[model samples]
Target chain A: MNYTLHEQEFTQQVADLIQQTACILPEDIERALVSARALEASDNVAYSVLDTILKNVDVARKQQQPLCQDTGLPVFYVHYPCGISTRIITRCIQDAVVQATADGFLRPNAVNPLTNKNSGNNLGIMIPCFHFMEWDKPEIQVACMLKGGGSENMSIQYSLPDAKLSAGRDLNGVAVCVIDAVIKAQGNGCAPGIIGVGIGGDRVTGMQSAKKQLFRLLEDENEYPELDKLEKSLLAQLNKLEIGPMGLGGKTTVLGVKIGMVHRIPASYFVSVAYMCWACRREVMSYKL
Target chain B: MNKKIEMKTKHIQLPMNKINTRKLKLGDKVLISGIIVTSRDMAHRWMMEEKSDIIRPYLKDGAIYHCGPIMVRDGEKWICRAAGPTTSIREERYQSNIIQEYGIRCVIGKGGMGKRTAQALRTFSAVYLSAVGGAAVIYANSVQSVKAVYQLDAFGVPEAMWVLQVKDFPAIVTMDANGNSLHEDIEKKSIQNANQNQ
Candidate 1:
């Protein structure tokens, strides 16, 4: 199966996707937030704070405004056909970012890590990062996540069975490590956050899997029953910790939890916890040529 | 303990002094209406080193906010796009000195400061206001106008200091001048919660 697409139209579509993601909360996230708001204790101030956020979400979508100022670096995961030219896709995405930034759909956020200078259009060396995968599907798949800087700071990786945590090298230990990370966040990751857990991988792969889990919808269940149960239990336990919205103490500390697993070497168990603020700015696009 | 009693929010006004700050307690709700300066990591460090005259006059009665906002330029004027609070824990190293030097009465940001910052707030008669993080669009709407922007070339837009006049800016009292810190209490309580859950 093959489809033809115009280069310029494709670029515009990618830009539209980026801008659309920046301006609106994805449906799953919106529903989760609404439900979380409903579940919060009436006395909890986090409920009111979350109300402000919910209203802001409405305004952002109505006014076509970026939900959060951070409008973090645009990270892309592309699923392109084997015969497609990734070079063209990369260039188109880069140009789209610049256009989006100029249009104020994105903040000029990509800065020179060394010089501390902003590119003014969100394009920098290896910025607006792209991860390409060759897929059999003919339609190009594009997904983006506007991960905030504050929550990104909360992302942590741990080597399991640590004596400090009494964590053993098992799934139970992974649960412990992930929960510990959440407790450490103390609402700093912009609570009522979505926790993405990566288990059973080496350090780099562990972090990657953690991030990839963020693309999964909050309403979706993991195919593996064990991992699915882990996500559910973790979500319940974290909320019980009363880390509530902004850590103000309530029943809805986490909107959801997602876990991804990969085979690891016998010597080590690595876990990466990626905390996403409730905004969860993710959108997907497919252009059938 | 009644979480209901804890949930009752008490609003507060800005331009607070030692006495006014003392009246604030942890977990009290506050809605601040006043002028505040936006400054982040690099701006705080720059203030210590360069002693920028631009920020001095504003410091007399103004609070400082920890934020890196999204701003849109319309001709020569600027509009606040999404001016939400950034995490405040990152400024623990410099917050104490900045609070004292600037004669700042309030420090608005998300998350909260540590023991050292709590001590500074106690000594300086200042309070820490925890704004709702990730509610940038809401915050931007609170801004009345952008008075001025400086150091764009040196610190870049997000890191640069912008003098903003705001009205009814919402926040919670997380750090009171009397040395009570809600964030500290939360961390301790959360750890206990984790232990019990395990």
Candidate 2:
């Protein structure tokens, strides 16, 4: 009646996944950081900070500990196979998060927005946020991202035909807006950052699609040729901004750029940029159903 | 606040007085050694509201780190597991007031704050230091002792007041009392660079 793994076992696996996602920095992110460091000037403070970051990454791994104190809110983008209960999966994920928090693998980061209270167990209203998508494959694929607050606060959305920046209703307009977002953020989004851009959706989905890009591998190319070109161009342009690592002023401001698109109403053109810190913590795990 | 202490290069000897902090320029690399109190949004609010005479003694002449660290209890004692600077801009509205209220000499955080806080630093004879964002693991190693903590039930763990004794804690003087700000300079220059790149 259930998937290949028992429900309890499935829950345990998800907990381990959260723990791994929290503690381990992905290889692609590590590579990008090292390359960014290489690009910085010898005298720049960005170089020294990057050196310390690399060392910090090493220590977190050797100790098998969380990379940052603010381990971040766990976001699960689930590609569930047919016949699985959504309620069951959600409950199991919440249980896993609580387990991780108790074990010290995750900080108690979740808080009640209205009351300013935290459950101390990483469980609150819609905490361990999930994005579910049905898939043809029998096995379940769960891609988890730890969205930290600092960069999340910097996530932005802009309407097309904006007059202030001379932005219009085209891809060029999107480029200007995206670059503008990066520029305003300066070192505040915890640069150097990975920008996940969403174009052509309503305000909500526009932001959602942008966050979805964070789930992609850092080095992976976009599926669409045009989006790919945009990613390449933006990545090149953002670095030239020279915001550098920790905003200390250097040659590297962005490690990667990912963009996703969706159909939108004729009247609206929304572009959302989701700024992700260089820690860029995420992991995708699969199990047979 | 002077004993004519020997200076350690790359480290800011703490319990920082005006003389020592004023000496630090923008982008000066230093590791801090001394007691620093940790407080975030609500703690800042409470400090302003309560302004308790009891705590002012501890806060004066000490650093306020804009961080919400992960701490676990080891029996009666607490241990800092992972402590890194949170974005200081969120506290921008309240930081200046807190600084002026208490004779706070230094502020340690990341992603440098705004104009009001910068002006306040100049007015009050203080400086803003930046700890490396995402440098939690190493920052944790720098926390030599957890002297005390307060207000857990009301504010929660991340929002609690953690009084920490740190040694060789790493940070940079991103905002100096001399009215210089690295973030502002970078923002200005980056806008110019963006125009040129286009």
| Chain A TM-score of each candidate structure, as shown | 0.96, 0.96
Q: Candidate 1 iRMS, in Å?
A: 3.1
TM-score of 1: 0.95
Q: After superposition, how far is residue A28 of candidate 2 from its true place, in Å?
A: 0.6
Candidate 1 residue lDDT tens string, A194-239:
9998887888889889999999999899999999998999888988
Tens digits of lDDT, candidate 2, A1-289: 4565477988889999988887788998999898887876655688778988898999988886778888888899888887887788888889888898887778898788899898899887778789899888887788889877888988999988899989998889999999999988887778889999999899999999999898788789899998899899999999898888888788889898999999989999999999999888899889788
Residue-level error in angstroms, candidate 1, position A96: 0.6
Give the TM-scores of the predictions, in the order they appear: 0.95, 0.96
- State in Å the error of residue B149, model 2: 0.8
